[model samples]
Structures are given as structure tokens and as C-alpha cells.
Target: MQNTPENDHEQDAAPSKTRRKKDMHALQEIGEQLVELDPKKLNEFDLPEILLDAIHLARPMTKHGARRRQMQYIGRLMREVDMRPIQEKLDSWQQVSVHQTARLHQLERWRERLLTDEHALTEFAEKYPVADLQHLRLLIRNAHKEKAAEKPPKSFRLLFQALQATITEV
Candidate 1:
């Protein structure tokens, strides 16, 4: 016999414990993969062919061990690379225009609209009504609050109160 609507509702409301565990594991794997795609990894894959050919010459094997060994080599290189110094240098050498700051504020507001009001965010992030955008919502919400706090609020409360007082007196 097919499950009744009530039974189906319960089934969906309480997914098997195993299914939740599997989903959590899948999300963890995706997070790890994203963290591993560092700027150095991107550059290594995108560098000019001549430079790549030279690096390839130093490692003349197409063996499966190459990837494992190269990762270890990269880990070592990462320790020696001071990214903060480079970032500081870049920041010192570059300037942000007022337009860029305004654009950032606009992005912040969009993130807020997506977050505190999540049905819309889910549609945007997943392109489906059933999708969850909870994590993104939290991230954007916090950032939006921070950005809004940075700006002085426009003054309308006194004028609003004066108008209200006049109307009430009338």
C-alpha cells in the first residue's frame, strides 16, 4: 500500500538519520575541495606553457604518485610563502575609489535582502523552491549588519515626530 499523505509528510519531516549523515559528509568534502583550490594551485594550472614545460621536465613521470607527491611539495612551499606580506604590498600599492566602496555597499544590501528574507535567496542560490540557502543567509546577514553599522543613519525621526505631534494635536 502507498503511504498516506500524513505518512509521506512524516517521512519528509524526519529523514532517516543515515541520510542526514550522508548529506553532512558530502558538504564536508565540497568544503575541503574549495579550500584546496588556492591561488597557487590556480596559477600552477594556468601558467604559460613554456614555464609549465620547464616544470614538467623537472618531474618526468606520469605516475599516479605524482599528484600525491606534488601536493606534499605544495604544502612545503606554502609554509615558505608569506601571503600577508604580498597582500600588504598590494594594498599599499593600490587605492579604492569612492565608486568601488559604493558598489561594495550595494552588494552588502543585496546580501541582506537575500538573507533575512530567505525564500528569495533560496530561489537565487539553488534555482529551486526546495533548496536551502541557510548558510549563505547567515554569512550575508552578519556582513550586512556590519556594513550598515559603519554608516551614519539619516536623520528623519525628529521631523517625523513633529509631523505626528501636529497631526495628533489637530
Candidate 2:
């Protein structure tokens, strides 16, 4: 057969040995991450029982060589399963964690502002109309006294809880 553009295109389309190795290594890394996940979290993936058994089997192995081989076996098993949904779920879980962290930071900033600034309550009420302004004002006042007396920050914590409830409701 004569060399042709079509033949060259087919060759290019085929994954090279290096590419296959990289793909296998990536799958292996994902398998490792799966092994680290909690059993409950792992069940969410709905993996094949054989793969799940392999993962569960690997979970308790302390020997480095044995665990590595089990991981390789898991990777080999993973090759037969579609990874897109699993990867997507993992990514979404990460996104949820990031969102929760950001939300906590925002609530903390609000708590600080309310503690230090006189006008913060009014601003908070305006932003979150569902807030119990009277209750919050009382908590803030008590929180100030607690800070001055160096008491356990019960009111401060209550104030944060109030803010969380008020903010999350909206």
C-alpha cells in the first residue's frame, strides 16, 4: 500500500505508547483518590462491585508494595468503567466545599463588622430584612460586655448563629 494522507491521519488518530501510559497513570491517580474517600462517599459513585471490592480491600493494606499493586488493579478495573460521571461528581463536591468556605468567610466578616461598627446592624438589617433586628441588637450589646469582661464569648457565638440563620434564610 502506498503512503497516503488518509493513512497518515489514521496514524495520528491512534494514541501513542507514551499517551497510553499517561492515560493509565491518570486513571491510577483517580483510583488512588477514590481509595481515600470515605466508604459512604465512595458508594455515591456506584462503581462496579468488583472495583468496589478492590477499593475496600485496599483500604486497610498498610504494606506499600501490596497497596500499590491493588491500586494498579483498581486502575485496570477502572479502565472498563466510564469515568466521566465519577470525575464530575468529585469536581462538584470540591466546588460545594469551596462555596461553603466562601460563605463562612462572608458570615465571619459580617460578624466582625457588627462587633466593631455601630452602623453594621442597620446595614445588616437593610441587607437581610428577615433578620430579627431587636434580637441581634441585644446579642451585640451582650457580646460587647462579654468582650470587655473577657468572658466566654457565648453572646458572640449566638450573634454569629443569628447572622448565619438570617443570611442563609435569604
Best by TM-score: 2
> How close is every model to the real structure, measured as TM-score?
0.20, 0.84
Cα lDDT, model 2, residue 91: 85
Task: Give the lowest summed-lDDT range of ten residues in model 2.
Answer: 38-47
Residue 49 in candidate 2, Cα distance off native in Å:
1.8
TM-score of 1: 0.20
**Per-residue lDDT for 13-108 in model 1, tens only?**
996999866754543333223234444543533334443333343244466576445434433333334445434433443445455566556545
Off by over 4 Å in 1: 1-8, 40-170
User: Model 2 — TM-score against the truth?
Assistant: 0.84
Error of 2 at 56 (Å): 1.3
Instruction: Give me the displacement of residue 148 in model 1, in angstroms.
Output: 73
Q: Can you list the residue pairs that collide in candidate 2?
A: none
